[model samples]
Target: MMFEYMDKMVMFQDTPEGLTADMGWLKEAGENGWELVSSVPLIAPNRDGIAYGTVGCQMILKRPKPTQ
Candidate 1:
C-alpha cells in the first residue's frame, strides 16, 4: 500500500537571527510528524564572509491517523 505523507519547505536567512526563528518553527513542525529530509544554506561564500543568501530547510512527515 502507498502511504500518504506530508512535505514542508522552510526558508530562513543566513544570519544567526534567521536561523533562530527557523529552528523554532522546525521544532514545532517536527512535533507534528514532520521529519527533516534535507537542508542547505542558501549563501554562496566568496572571498568575504557569508554571501547574500538564505537557508532552505525541507521536511517530510507521515500523516496522522484519523480519530474515528
Candidate 2:
C-alpha cells in the first residue's frame, strides 16, 4: 500500500510576557487526518552546567502516506 505524510507543531516562550497555544491549528490538523506522534519540550543549558527549561514546546505530527 502507498501513503502520504504531513506534519504540524505549536510552540511558546518562557518569558514573563505570556504564552499562547494554537489548539485550533492542531484541531484542524487532526481534522485533516494528522496524528500526534510526539510532544517534546525545548531546553537550553547555561554556564552553570545545568539545563534550564523554557516555555518552548515541540510537537511532531504525521499521517499515513496517500497513494497515487
Candidate 3:
C-alpha cells in the first residue's frame, strides 16, 4: 500500500474569529479526503530571540495514494 501526505499550516490571531477560520480550513481538508494524522503547535519568536506563544498549528495529514 502507498500513501500520500500533506502538511498544512493554519495561522490565527489568537481570537475567536481566528479559531473559526482555522476550523474551516481543517474542515475543508477533511472534505477533500485528507485524514488528520497529527497536529503540532507552531510558535513564533520575538525579535529578541524568545519564544512567545503558539500562533498557529502544523497539521499533518495522510491519504491513500491514488493509482492511475
Candidate 4:
C-alpha cells in the first residue's frame, strides 16, 4: 500500500476566536480523510531566551494514496 503526506503551517491570533477557527480547519481536514499525525509548535524565543507562546503550528497529515 502507498500513502500520501501533507505538511501544513497553521497560524492564528492568540485569542478564543483564533482557536475556534483553527479547530474548524482541522475538522474540515478530518472530514476529507486527512489523518492528523503530529503537530509541532512554532514559537520564537523572547529576548531572555524563554518561549512563552506559539505563533503557529506545523501539522502533519497522511492519507492513503489514490489509484486510477
Pick the lDDT winner.
3
Instruction: Write model 1 residue lDDT over 1-68, tens digit each, in one string.
Output: 23357666666544755463346766777676656655545444567785755556455666455555
lDDT of each: 0.58, 0.69, 0.83, 0.82
Which lDDT value does model 3 have at 6? 99
Superposition-based RMSD of candidate 1 using all C-alpha atoms, in angstroms: 5.5
After superposition, the stretches of candidate 3 with alpha carbons farther than 4 Å from their true spots are 16-21
Worst 10 residues of 1 by lDDT: 13-22
Give one digit per residue, the lDDT tens place, for model 2 in 17-38. Answer: 6776657787888898888877
Tens-place lDDT per residue, model 3, 1-68, is: 79899998877664655553347777787888899999999888999989998888888999888987
lDDT of 2 at 29: 81
- Give the TM-scores of the predictions, in the order they appear: 0.39, 0.63, 0.76, 0.70
Model 1 regions lying over 4 Å from their true place: 1-3, 16-21, 37-54
TM-score of 4: 0.70
Q: Which is the better candidate, 1 or 2, if ranked by lDDT?
A: 2
List pairs with backbone clashes in candidate 1.
none
lDDT (C-alpha) at residue 59 in model 2: 78
Candidate 2's displacement at residue 55, Å, is 2.1
